[model samples]
Target: MTQKQDGDPKSLSAEEAKAEFLALQERLRAADIAYHQEDAPVISDAEYDADKRRYAALVAAFPELEKDATQLNSVGAPAASGFGKVSHAVPMLSLGNAFEDEDVADFARSIRKYLGLSVQDPLAFTAEPKIDGLSLSLRYEDGVLVQAATRGDGSVGENVTENARTIADIPEQIAGAPRILEVRGEVYMSHDAFAALNQRQQERGGKVFANPRNAAAGSLRQLDAEITRSRPLQFFAYSWGELSEPLADAQIEAINRLRSLGFSTNPLTRLCSSLEEMIDHYRSIEAQRATLGYDIDGVVYKVNDLSLQGRLGFRSTTPRWAIAHKFPAELAWTRLEAIDIQVGRTGALSPVARLAPVTVGGVVVSNATLHNEDYIAGRDSKGAEIRGGKDIRVGDWVQIYRAGDVIPKVADVDLSKRPESAEPYSFPHVCPECQSPAIREEGDAVRRCSGGLICPAQAIEKLKHFVSRGAFDIEGLGNKQVEQFYADEWIREPGDIFTLRERFGSGLQQLKNREGWGEKSAANLFDAIDEKRTVPFAKFIFALGIRHVGEVAGKDLALHYGEWSALTSALDAARAAALAHRAADEAEDAERIAAEAEGRRARISETRAAAIKACGVPNEAQAAWDDLVGTDGVGPILALSLSDALANPEERAAIDRLADHLNIVPPDAPAAESPVSGKTVVFTGTLEQMTRAEAKARAEALGAKVSGSVSKKTDILVAGPGAGSKATKAAELGIKVLDEAGWLELIG
Candidate 1:
């Protein structure tokens, strides 16, 4: 076994550490399930300790790896079946990890940074022993225990109220508490109780639990409440989920309040004023780990102030307010078999590494991600060799480790055991699914297939994207139905989705007679499809599935254009400008070239001015290219891609056909009864009545165009306290100008 130096993750290369970290995460997660859910022993306690330590050292060494790595502080596996599921109001978030003393200091520093506090300022933290057991959430309504649940996947949990009522430590009712309260804590069995239960199991020739944590989890998950009552399960209130009213201002006070409410709160939790004190508390807890009646894996540190915690908020899956410093992991070795390329919805080819099955941590991992070709070639994105240029090849012995819930990766390859037939794998340069030419553009590590509309893979992917939750979101037209339609020739394009009832509703082979379709179901599907005919401008744009144009970009384009016709006209003008510019560049004669260039420039300038006038703003395309690219969040690359797609004759025809059948609504007009409604209004300087954003929103809501700058087409300019250049421009353009009060009166 290779022992990692304390606090030094740099001992291994970046690739090595990442692979080991991912493997350790998976291993630890499986170990957690076996120890906490299944009541089984896959590895010895010492081995589990070693795996956890190594995993922590790797994380501390390379902090950047933490972003993609599995969460280090998650307690148990997902809740087992046999109970109904309950959706939690506030998500049950997990904590981050702190392995060493420096890590603890960094945690404190991060909290200070998030809260904008200085080093000298006092920031208290509450330190508590991280209990090793199943997590339970008890809900109380009007001071009565109404519902109890186990944290399933953080968002939902299994309803275990009957099982929870059996635990003596749990309170059936609490006086002087909020009307709605959810107390979250750990449920565990003491060491002595576990020993006694295991002794009884052995005498009866039944399955004996390997540990108390496992015993408690197995006992509490029993389908029969009477069986759970027979077990010696205990509950310790340490935190909470949802509450109708505030418990207290600080963390320590809340725990004390839980204890006062007849809940068995952990007695060892302490408040520390400094990092030194917190570390001292951690050491004390570790020293008393064996003597503690219940099992504890590590110490947890949370920001003492509830307001500071609120400000800190959460990461994707964990709260930034707290961290659990864990112990080390177990390790194993496996052989690399082959590497495979899998194309995603956007046509980006991702590499997957196939490996010989090996158990590390506790689960069998047969595959890991090579990330990209660069990773397989033993180089970083910048072409720098990693791990001394140790490229992974087929038939090489590789070390693997698991931590929490992270996917396993190839840590280090054993060159000594490399097979004689091992060869360097070549990444594919073509789309394996469609036989299309895949290109890797500059500044991009990913290679994407360029056969848009023609490639079946790209077509199907786009169709799936169109019906996604954020896109068209049409009910009864899920991915499977879309796939079946596409395969059966019933639908080849998005436009076909709208024309389904027209083409096949009265035919002999009607949709009602299909395998999954009945008369009511077919009618429902048609009704659902028809109901989406008049979609919002943003939703329509997003449903197009143009590359790089996500939900945000779609809304941006919609707001910028205001109407579908305007957007199409702008794109057409842009296409014309591109052609003119190209023609000017290709002219060989100096005089002719100069003439063409001048004409092109004039055409572009004219188009821009026309766009500005129509839109009642100063945003004019220097060229058609500038108009699309200038929109917020729509960069040159995305703009070019959109224009190119629109420029294609076949694509344009299909879009036109789709547009013909649908009524694409323009941007909403402001409400009536206001004089400035439907007019282009510009706001300048500071508004005393409201913020600038509020003023603009109010104008737009009243069916007025809120422009940023004054132009000839601008109907009115609302000048405020500090009005300057814009006001003068409005006057020069002979546009009407109003003070803040005057504008408000006019609107009223």
Candidate 2:
């Protein structure tokens, strides 16, 4: 019995099987603890599922022995808490999963029958990826994320406060002032990061993660935050459990609200007005699963209308309003033309596929991601020797398919499809954008340019990024416009944008004299530029387009660095220090130059540290800087962007010119509004002051723009529960993420 309990296959007697059943319960419980509370898991889903199924069968056969089988009735353990715990306004529940298309169709049929509607009836369903990850219940008070919890059982679970904070995707607060709200969703690991992490673990002689789902579960469960911090995690919100006020009249609106609040809701999500569209979406997603960068076993279909969903009610673990449409796990073949490396704002080198133009679904896809180097050189299923053109080279036909939309990756290469003359791809030794030498950072597979802001490609991309909706938001200047300007010698640097009015004034005047460009239209365009001139410090920082800087980061930078003049001085000093540290390393004075190097690195990477250092004297601190740094959530990335921008002479001049007219003034410090002021307000997340619908209505009533995401035109991002990506991007762009309290303080 003891041997059976310990997973010894040899001990397969009936009595031993009974004992093993009890042990299985304990194992499952422990696994659940690791998964739900800590945001990590110890075993693969297949292994866990096998054990669970085996235990279930044993308990069913031996009801007498089932008395000790705690799996059936035991409530889950509570998570270790770092935040104040609060009961959810509504209980967040899990969905029943399906493993086949037929099962999904059956579910759809059942839903129709339950509602007494014929299959031909105009029933609408929204199909989205069923994300496999940890579930979280976010609670908002006055539009702030006051508490977040793990979904333990159907009813209760452990508190994972500190663990949640490590997830940058989760927002700490939302905008708008609703009384209460609760949102629920899954948090998981990205495939690339998961593979990288597992590789590191294997190299270190540690256990390897079987998949991204397991990796996510494992990362979240670590008792030490430092461990969790090392893992790359992402989140996607699909539903809400409860709210103080009805968020939206429709389920689609609710999801939209969640997205606006800063959560990474699936952008592919669509609202279905008819069953055909719903089924089409399900089939379409099933077909395109291989292109999505995550693993998803199935698509979760839900009713589009909140009222209709409410009318349907729910079962024990699953909602009656929703069903999972499972896609078959299969791979498909496609040709890979060439591999191109793209450097992100964070300097992560991603391999992109230049494929033979193929139509998958409605879109023509000419590119696919190659993932990492190891994938390119790997073999296939048939054991027929997977070969690239030269060696995982261009002109190789590849196979790909998704278990789900969570991670889309290359599965195999067809040697026969390789072109006879295809050449082996040689990765550039230098940054493609800049002439600077590229170096792989410590323990990282991706090589990055050491050129910093000197690279033309990097600079152009940064400028475009800065002008993006979440950043400086120069309306007429979009990606194409910026690219054209950069290519045509219209703008050499970010600061050159400020001088555009002087350079293009004649162009504008001439245009007004032409057929299409009226004086009023040209004046409006100029006015738009003028509007962006006196931008806020955070926006200004984001507009500089530094590597890794986003809206949230931009805000953090602005608050820390304060005034432009002071920040520039600090960056110059920091740049000098970074140079010194590099020199010290080359000279082998690693220990002797430790302090000097330390000071330099801190300025480069440490946002708060550098700001504090920069703000050495009382007189050196500007009121805005002091207040900015003192703000609750400001941090490092923001500080760096601010410092860099301030250091640029061009930026300084741009600021001076803009300040001459469009001086950035803080929003009327949380004050009462005029009855009829045509004001603008942007919502950042879930609102606790009012329901999302109510908030939008109120904004419209007050003559404000109710937008989907943060843009230059957006007045606010009325955020509520589970705000994630939007918030981060907003910060990167220097847009504000106001809490309900702040919003109410201002509006009231």
Candidate 3:
């Protein structure tokens, strides 16, 4: 048998696969929240898509992961709590991505296979410029606009009817239309409007958007309709969410009908009869990307025949009838001036490339992330050669690639242009800010500072994160303010924010008497701080800045544990078990390592047997570890990290100190009385009545846990047409199987 490659997902141990899957889930979920709910994307389109593809591959390599793959089915973050939730009659599904010409061809092939079309049979498709903007759905009844919503979580969205009515391109009334129609499209900002808005924001000392997409989203999602009206936003109607009558039997005609009915549509749309035509259109749109005066990340291809689209059906998160052909990342070459290291909140030392100022993807870049020391050494963590193993050096020419607002990255280094005096720069072995020894652990790619709380860089960054918008969100407390307070020794940690007023309110060094402060502004800051004295438990967890515990994990943990006492109880139980196991495992490890050091092969071999006996914990203690790991999103890796963070003397003290000053409230509970409440439900094959996303949202609303696969834990399986192995497995496991009709009746 041929062996798989070293880094292949298929070759990963069962434990490794589980750990990596959970991490990928966290990464994707965080990116989704940032992109959809926050209106700010943390990673580039390419990186997000790559992570998604990796998730898909891992699931393929190890099918057991599917049962825990709820993240794969998520469309976007849930609708913001600020607005009323509007459930879409027909879910607004996301389109799958196609990055290469082959992917496009495969998409066509899959469509043909689903339709049973012969190779000679002509297949028609509609190709349009995929606008880089926010998705919106406008509902009209009797030619009068009644409601509008953002495509939040694909199924339920935020009601933004008043804001949508203000866009000039979106007509409030149409002359002739069906009694009920839900026109769907994008809300975007033109390049000119984006620049002007940024300039205005700067002049007014307000937040500046990173890109036109962010600007448009921020403008449209404003609670005040007057604020949205004042912003120069535009709309383009390209699809429909729910319809009373069919506009046309084909995709192109439907778009035309939308345009005729007084809605702006993308003019670059074209009908393609073959896969070659689709690729050509994609290329053509990409060529015009820079000159279009607006952002278009890619081209979207859709099945031309509406009936064929209906037949193609939908996946959990995307429609099978459509795919987006994304463009490659924009790249430019620049001279590498220097390499610097920056310590993060986690004490990880990250290398940064200082480049001669050059524009990449319309953004001037003087710096790019070097990822870690291995990357600077021209090798990946696995020692695989990258960029032909040509190490990056100072004064060498490097190619920087940037995708939109994401940080620019050094893509390649040109050895031919290297200066005579250029050197392979030595990565620092200590923290640059504090001179603390940086230690690189086994299997870890980056060296991290060992100074812990004493490292000023780590302390400052953690403090900054504590007050960020997603965390405590203290008003008038930005990064600069946090740094200034830290440098002055007035505030050192998160808890210090709560003590500031008590410490300096009446003294000559009062915050009001400080530079950049006045009595009114100071009072407002204190009021903001006081208002945040009662923080939601999820925010508090995220504000702790624990490694591997992000906003998503915080929400997961909050949902799992419900209250502070229960969470702490679980942590304590797990910690005791973890300590017992660690001590035993370390003793066994020491014996085995010592045996190997003495070249005692037989003794080393015997340690494997001894390790098993040594590492075993009491059943009750083992159950504690299992209980924490069983939390839907937390795996062995994150569970251990969370346990260690709680076990650390200093970190635990800091957390408790911070908690003492705040009243932590639990998140709103899900519906608990529904039939599917607390039960695991799985959906397989194609549902005839509604899309997969809609079914999932409905099930979740009833407090059911919807999984992607059938297993012993699955309480119910909603099987539909073409149900295969999952259906068989559900039957084998005696899972309650329901057809589409039965599922609908039960839910009703």
lDDT tens digits, residue span 612-718, model 1 = 34443322333655767657556544565577778889878888887887888776653565677778999998888755655776676566878787888799999
Candidate 2, residues 195-227: lDDT per residue as tens digits?
Answer: 789789989998786567767866766667788
lDDT of 3 by residue, 1-748 (tens): 0011125787664444654566556557667867887776656676677668878877889876764565677787667645788999999889899889999999998877666678999889999998888999999999999999999878889999999989999999997888999999999999999899989999999988777888898888898999999999999889997888999999999999999999999999999998888888888888888899998888999999998787676775788899999888888999988888888788888777888998767656687767677778887555667777888898999987766666567778888899888877898887898998999854455588998899999999899878866678777888899998998998888998998878766542567778998888887777888999998998888888887776656878899899877887888877766765445444545664566578864353355455545666567667878777788766555666788888889988888888899999999987668889999999998987766766786787677988887778999999999999999998888889999999989888
Global fold similarity of model 3 (TM-score): 0.78
* lDDT-based ranking: 3, 1, 2
Higher-ranked by lDDT: 1 or 3? 3
Clashes of each: 23, 67, 0
Error in Å for residue 231 of model 3: 7.0
TM-score, cand. 2 vs. native: 0.41
Candidate 2 off by > 4 Å: 1-330, 341-350, 359-363, 371-391, 402-408, 416-423, 433-436, 450-454, 506-522, 557-662, 666-748
- Compute the lDDT of residue 376 as modeled in candidate 1: 75
Local lDDT at 308 for model 2: 65
Native-referenced Cα lDDT, model 3: 0.81
Clashes of 2: 67
Q: Against the unseen true structure, what C-alpha lDDT does each candidate score?
A: 0.73, 0.58, 0.81
Worst 10 residues of 2 by lDDT: 1-10
Which portions of model 3 miss their true places by more than 4 Å? 1-44, 51-95, 106-125, 134-167, 172-184, 187-233, 239-254, 271-277, 287-291, 303-321, 505-509, 579-613, 672-674, 681-703, 706-748
- Model 2 gets an lDDT of 0.58
Which structure among the candidates has the greatest TM-score? Answer: 3
